[model samples]
Target: MSSQTLNKIPLISLVGPPNSGKTTLFNYLSGKKFKTVNYPGSTVEYSISKILSKHAVNADILDSPGIISLIPSSPDEQLSVNTLYSHPKFGKPDIVAVTVDVSQLSRHLYLVKQLLESNFKVVVVLTMTDVLYKKGFDISENKLSSILNCKVVRVNGKTGKGIDSLLTVLKESLNEIEKDSAASLIKADKHHKTKLLESYSEIEKIEKEVLFETDQKSTNGKIDIQKINESIVVLNSAPKFLKADETSLKIDKFILHKFWGLIIFFLIMALTFTSIFWLAAPLMDLVNDGFSFLSENAFTLLGEGLIADLIANGLISGLGSVLVFLPQILILFLILGLLEDSGYLARGAMLIDKPLSKIGLNGKSFVPLLSGFACAIPAMMATRTITNKRERFLTIFIIPLMSCSARLPVYALLIAFLIPQETPWIGGLLLAAIYVFSITSSIIIAAIVNKFSNRLVKEKDNTSFILELPAYRMPKPMRVIQETIKNGKQYVVKAGPVILFLSLLIWILTTFPNYDPVVPVSPDVSPEQTEILKSNERMSTSYAAYLGKFIEPVMAPLGLDWRVGVSLIATFAAREVFVSSMALIFKITEEGDDMQNSILNSMREAKIGDSDQKLFTTATTAGLIVFFVFALQCLSTVAIAKKETGSWRIPVLQVVVFTALAYVFAFVTVNGLRAFGVN
Candidate 1:
């Protein structure tokens, strides 16, 4: 092969087990700041960046989703495995870079062995050498390299230590392969029929040759023990000597204590909810005022016409309803990112493992379930860590019930309206209660699903939960802030367009058919009342009102009128759109009033037909909260669920089952509360 042909844009892939600092190395090599965290399954999707290495020009580096083995299990693992050979878009990578945690060498080497057997040009990057030294194990890269017949480089991904040497080794290895093209081609040909049993035997041989126990207490204290491939081995000075850091052990003792841990967990969660309200309040108010100003000024400039209504009522007011909650969304992710980056999230998962197992999941499932509170899309993707197919699907099924941040706008709006802001503590407690209720409901539903799924699928449960708790470290503030902003931006990018489209559709539906009121304009009636009457007359014959009436029969049982029914339909696009839809509808009804004032006052004063009874009573608000909690309203979530599961049936079933549960629970809650004289 010619040098020119061998130098064709080199593609390098980074692959590793979860939380092994694979992405950190990718950032170092590519000089890009992709998000990294202490927990597993953080990289739900792959990232590609142009490599900036001096030795390797025109190189494109791909950071694939983390995987435990080449034998694919979850969607993420499958993607990683597929990327190694012939990715449809990325093509086959010229070289594979495997990151192995030296502290957990025995476990990490399993994937490396598989990669070697597959005949790919592989380089093993040993991460966490300092961590390995802390654990009292000294690893020799040269020894491991000789045993595995591959190049090994040790580097600290965070500090950029030894990165230049690794790149140099990669360039040397590529040149060596190019020189021995005939042998390389021959080795590639043999990989097609590589035997797994043979590979496993070779891995066992390599493990014995390169790994050793360090003990100083007794004569010949390093005596060999039975080979344990599944569990991690912690080297110590003696058989009984504890290897864990004293500080971490002490912290875990209190934080992982069952009773205390549960209490502390709830307290932390309560604080998080409280902070969302307290921290985001001023920013939310600013956003609200800004949008209100835009709406008023645009109305004045455009004058009374469809264009003004479109710009002010349809666009500004609708977008404002969702935008006002962006600060809260940012805060939620910021808090979660801190928890995850501090390595406490894994300990929390460990604390909840027993309870989760009773519901047919384990600590691994808890991370994804916890993430569902931020967003179900990524939460669903985070289930890639659950190797068991049954447990992964079950976790995905209940994630939407966890009350994601998208529901924050609706919850905050309704809760504020329902409970006075003067009693903020009460509102905060109510908000926390909603989250607690969501978790409790998810557990119950998961338990029910587990019972039935066992009878339906009948697969043996061979997968065991094994969680590796990372060393505690301070979270990088810049990274956390960047990730939080990225998440908030994603919400805008994904839901913004849909909300704008729906707002316009709703505006048109309520605006047209040109119904001039048959009754003469009474001189005694105020202009606001006249506009309200005109709106009522027009909406009575408009398409949106027709949709509302069509769905009202179903919604009326939950104490919602046709207007609320219209908003509910719009929520199918996104849970937050419920607020925006209501804002637009109410703004259209009461013209010439401040948009903010019109929405709040209109909702408060709204009443049922032929009666003065308010529509948004305590019972109605509670029902709506319950409905939003259970309903799988986000279309993006459904699409992702379908894509992940590779079947439309699961997504369809999710929607049908969750929507029905929402309606039934809402109906029962509303009627039951009213019957108890709570309304």
Candidate 2:
């Protein structure tokens, strides 16, 4: 078999245990911006991209979910294993590029051995070698390669060190695999059916051949620490006795202290939320100004017809309402990514585990819950790490309460209208307080659910909390920027088209059934006032107003008028649609040549029916925020929930319960504020 005889695009799989820098390597090789986190189970699905190699052979590379072994313990692990041998979409890979963390060679070798024994073409790429070397333990890649009878190359995914060498080695290994008919060097028949004990025995034999250490201990008549150390040859410069990681230990002393850790976590989260407003303000202003310029030009060029209105008001203003918040979204992801890459996020999980376990979830659930702030979809997917069915279900059920980035646009709109700009810090504090309220509400709901659900399903006490805290290193700036841009672009790509269409739809619905104003014109009435009256009269008779009126009775208790009701109905598609819908509705209602007149001003001036009072009172704004915080309005989330749960019942139940709760809370908030004379 020659290279030309095989397929043109060779499939290369980068497989490794969790947090072995496999994703970083994948990103480097493929020139793609997949997320890289310092925690386990981050890569839940396989990402396939073309390898940007200068070699003659072009390859399609896959970064699979991290697995400890072929036998799966969780859904992510199962997916990874299935992709390796029997994926429904992508069949088994041609070559398995095993990424080995040099610091944890003994544990990682077990998977390498399994791959070799299973007759998979394997090439070992050693990562974290520098970390291992810094800790006074360095193993020769050549010697390790000779012992394993495979091609081994050292590479740093972050710095691109040794990547060229690894590519050269990969080319040779691929050629060798082609010559050998894509077979493993060591041929063993029926190795896939090898017993667990036999596999361990085989792994032990290899471990003893390469590692070296002093004063190792054995437990339960199993392979001893001495044998594990003897599997790798330690460099002569290595310390005679391994020392504890003093810096991490000292930091952990305070960071993991029960009281201090909790306080620090809250402070960090508060800063993160506050920064979303303070830091993103300038960029948001720029985006707003940019859209304003574009809208003005469109209106000037196209003139005052339907096309001009559609482009300038419907599309530009509507999309801009959502796009201005992109800066905030990027900042949020950047801060979270820094925390994750620095290994502080895992510690935060550890600190919160005890309280979470009390509510029937372990520390593993914390990652998904934290991820909910970005979006509920991936957070729900991340719940696959929870092996306990009941815990996993509970995590999924409560995820939507965390107030994802979709809600950020709505929050920013309402907060800007409600909170004054002069008091920037006050606005930031309000933003932080919203997130705090969301978390508090989620915990209360979880507690109530845990209390009742435990009686129905027997609580499992065997589930343990085991977390790995990677060495805290400076976050790669380029990586942070890449992820920020990638995520921000995703928001635009996913939400932009839907929002534009809905905006256009809303414009049509509000513009039709145009009525001739019969009201007598007065000389005192300005043209702007006349235009406002005509627009309001037209909207009152329009199709959108009819639908809003139909729902107005139901929403009246929450201080929302028919216009707000219309936007709320549109938000069922996505929370961010609320902003665009409002933008379109207000654009039609207000008489302004400038599309840049803050939507906040129009909202403030908006009146409810014949009332002289403003529609967006403090009470109304507060109530809207409450409703959005609790409502499961996203149809995509509902669909994903149904798919993940394998039934419509759970998703339906969530929708009903959350919507009812949102109504009740919103009613209370508005009425309570009104009672306190907060107009």
Question: By TM-score, who's the top model here?
Answer: 2
Local distance difference test, each candidate: 0.75, 0.76
How do the residues 101-154 of candidate 1 rate in per-residue lDDT, one tens digit apiece?
876666688788877767777899999877666544567788999887889998
| Model 1 stretches with alpha carbons more than 4 Å out | 1-8, 33-41, 53-56, 72-75, 133-149, 174-247, 258-264, 455-458, 515-519, 522-530, 588-597
Query: Under the 3 Å rule for N, CA and C atoms, how many clashes does model 2 have?
Result: 9
lDDT of 1 at 190: 28
- Residue-by-residue lDDT tens digits, candidate 2, 1-679: 2432444667788899887888788887888634332222377767887777553447778887888887776777777887787446445567889998866776688789888877787899999876665554566777788878888889987678988888887778777756666552343233455575676666555544554442223434676556456434333333223334557778887788878887888898778766776787778778767877887788779876678877877788777866876787778778877887777877887887888989877777888887678778777888887777678788899999987877876887788878776886676678778988988998999889888766534656557766677666787788777766776776677667876677777878877777455555999999778777877777778899999999999978887789999999888877777876776677532334333345787887788889886889999999999999999988878988888777786688889989998999999999999999997
Inter-residue clash pairs, candidate 2 = 207-231, 210-231, 210-232, 211-229, 211-230, 211-231, 211-232, 212-229, 212-230
| lDDT for 458 (candidate 1) | 50
**CA lDDT, candidate 2, residue 679:** 71
